[model samples]
Target: MAAVGSPAIVEASFISRLVTRKTVMIGLLILVVVAVLAILAPWIAPYSPSRLSVVNRLKPPGGTYWFGTDEFGRDVFSRTIYAGRLSLLVGASVVAFAAVFGVTLGLVAGFFRRLDTPIARIIDAMMAFPDILLAIALVAALGPSLVTVIVALGIVYTPRLARIVRASTLVIRELPYVEAARALGVPTWRIMSRHVLRNLLSPILVQGTFIFAYAMLAEAGLSFLGLGVSPEIPTWGTMIAAGRQYIGQADWMTLFPGIAIILSVLSLQMVGDGFRDLLDPRLRKDL
Candidate 1:
């Protein structure tokens, strides 16, 4: 048998394990389609997301407009596609930034007993409020914009990631291999970077997907409340906000955008679930 630690073994195991998960495969397909549509929105979108037309306002699904037009006569289909780009950007950016920053803090806090007390307290304080409320306040205070939204979401999510990583690090730091590395005179930084951090990939990945999904949802909530990106920019939240007034008269406007948010969030959650199941020790045993 190949060495359990070998790269080849790991690669084979990953593929074999991944193939058996139907939910993950379906989620990947949906996510890829959404991503590709977002990337190609500029060329494929029939009209500008924000282009207004007096003649086309509230136009229901029919000729000239696929999904129909919003109250402003903007193309719903075009706006939906473009919104995916920003929505996804926010989700990916928040998780990517927070994970890197939070993991570093987690590693430090976990490895050093003195720092843990202070860091944990701050994390606890931040986490006391609901994440959405905290994010709303942050955006309101920071002023609305894409950068602010990303930063706000990152700050809101960092505590959770920090807690997860810190717990994992605490466990890893006590393991026999870690003790051996310490006794053999390995530097703390070297041992952490090379040995301890590697074992953390599965949990980090699982947590990251959840964070990404929540960030996207939080951005939508903020935008719906008028605290997101500029009102001029096309976003699912903005579309829903605009459509909410005319929901009885024109349900398509709100319905399509709402569906977009649901599908995007659901896709991420499904993928996250797949990752969680794949990473579980019991599941690994079956594999």
Candidate 2:
């Protein structure tokens, strides 16, 4: 009998495969850069994001202040980098939370066809309202805070991720090896978790990247609308909203934060695409 591979082995294989693709390598590079920046923000940032300087308010980008000062005279460059930490937190937390619920439900629903219809219907119903709208509603109902935003985004994105995992599981469960294992009376849990879920790692990883990126953007939207992290905390969305008041007077206030959002999203998208190219065989052929 063929040995079932361990989860660590499967994950390592996926990582090795992901690294083999040049595009994915570039994506990894971008992610590393962003991660490093976020991690090092406190030490690297020239000034406290919240530190005020009324005399230097709205100063343009120049020496001593790369991205200039905001209307409150807070260092824009420092704020941007510092905001990245919270943005990264929102993205990582939302996706991790969503994956736990989504993947488990998807595996169960897919393997047990009897449960698929009801679960799928529920997911469909949730998805019927756009993800952003759902998140907004959830946040509004729950009230603004880090925990609420993370949970709201997780719920909003779970259906799509569940669908993706379910589709992959459906195909995998029907394969001959799965049938053989079933015939041999192997534990259903073992087959599902060890064999089935392992095979779906690539899609899960790629999907995770997109989810992470979208989560950050969504959190930003919530913050912009004053429904996210506290205004006292410096975040990209709050910065943009703050900058809007002074946009006519100092375009840099708004422009820099906008650029930060764009770059973060773009980097995540590129990484996701690169993962797709490496992981999905059909897409690999196209590449």
Candidate 3:
């Protein structure tokens, strides 16, 4: 057995904690399963998401049609499975976009007194608008499409990460190590990137998870409103929107996709909570 602080011991300890945490383990398992299913959708999905069968329209869930047929006679199960691809893609894209802009602005604002006021004001202004409203305005201006939705959501969410990063950077830049680095004439970029950026990772990571969930949900909302990707694409939101017309007769159409959305978002939230607990210095000992 390795010593307590050894790499192997630490790895084992992490695994122990992960297994002992029921919510985290469950969330992780669900996330893994969803990701795997999405990745393998082309093969795993019994039928093409868009394959239409007028003969099977509105069929309820059964052995032949797992999640049933939609109003368009398309496979609900296949569509829901495939929808994960776009949903996950949007979530990741938004997180990346938000982090890049948010981190840069935050670093500049916190490190440079002269730039702080302007950057902070901009961040505050962007955050003032409700996320959905801002996203809608942006998408309307940019023209509805996958890329537009991603960009709109990314812009809307960036301020959140920026605020968090700015607050953290303010405290971090004044720390003894940072002061020492400055005293030694370390390059500004190097000090900020190596010292400030590294320390801010914990909050960034925790916030990234929440942002991922938010992006997914926001995409769904946008699609539902017909302001997202074209209706032809098999997104969960589009599926739900299409099914709303047949609510009483074909509830399965919306049911499965909504469940997918719920599970994916819930799993992400639980995992985010777990990561927050694990990364927080005050909570690490309890874990």
Candidate 4:
């Protein structure tokens, strides 16, 4: 006779399947490389990102300057590396803030049906606004600054995360396990925290990764538009903005930073896709 599998066995089998998936492994590798680069930016940078060398201004890629020089004669390679740190920081922070707040609201809404309608209406209203527009409006209201940008992005993204969490929680709330937990005199908070939240982790994580990518891109866009980090900061968007005037004469300034932004966002998106695939119950079952 076949032996009955325990929950631990089922979980282990799921994890093994996820690890064996080629796409997930490749995505993880890409994410790891980006993360390492972001962490080692200061050590890896060839020169001070903000330092100006008037003599070498607008130099094309060569032996002396691998990625060339920007309009202000800042090392393109160095700035790109340093910018990665800021971009990644903003992305991670915004996503984390949004996820925590959104997930909490979603859980509350799902567990307490009395609150669902109002929460759903609020989320719907927020969702009606375009993300970039909403971010810009929020930033404009809060005034331009690093903290403002992060907060703006976080708020703009939170509603979407809340919706995702709410949908997931709705399904989970109906599950027998959740109902049993509630029937056992488990407090609403306990039932939502222990039973519903644990089941929603995979989806929340996958959504958070995508949100991080969006946050990165949004930060770059805002910086380019002069509403992001201060001009003093060497952000990829600011670099692009400053370089646009010299695009016809010197392309490296814009090209290098633009490419860096693209690669970082692409890496995150790839990881998100892989994570979604790995986390989906149907996909895991099929694998």
TM-score of each: 0.96, 0.92, 0.95, 0.93
Residue-level lDDT tens digits of model 4 in 1-287: 33459777768876787688777677677778767877898888878888899999999999888899987788988888788889989998999899888998888777779999999999999999999999999999999999999999999999988998899898899999888887888888788888889888888888898999899999999999999988988899999999899999888889988988887788777777777776786875565
Task: In candidate 4, list every pair of residues with a backbone clash.
Answer: none
- Tens-digit per-residue lDDT, 46-129, candidate 3: 999989999999999999889999977888999999999999999999999999999999999999999999999999999999
Best by lDDT: 3
RMSD, candidate 2, Å: 3.2
User: Can you write out model 2's per-residue Cα lDDT over 241-261, one digit (the tens) per residue?
Assistant: 998888888888889888888
Ranking by TM-score: 1, 3, 4, 2
Name model 2 segments beyond 4 Å from true: 1-22
Judged by TM-score relative to the true structure, which candidate is superior, 2 or 4? 4
Instruction: Tell me the whole-model lDDT of each prediction, alpha carbons only.
Output: 0.91, 0.89, 0.93, 0.87
Q: Which stretches of candidate 3 lie over 4 Å from their true place?
A: 1-15, 285-287
- lDDT at 118 for candidate 2? 97
Cα distance off (Å), candidate 3, residue 139: 0.3
Decreasing lDDT order of the candidates: 3, 1, 2, 4
RMSD over all Cα atoms, model 4: 2.3
Question: Which has the higher TM-score value, candidate number 1 or candidate number 2?
Answer: 1
**Worst window of 10 by summed lDDT in candidate 4:** 1-10
After the best TM-score superposition of candidate 4, give how far the Cα of residue 276 lies from its true spot, in angstroms: 1.2
For every candidate in turn, the CA RMSD to the true structure comes to 1.4, 3.2, 1.7, 2.3
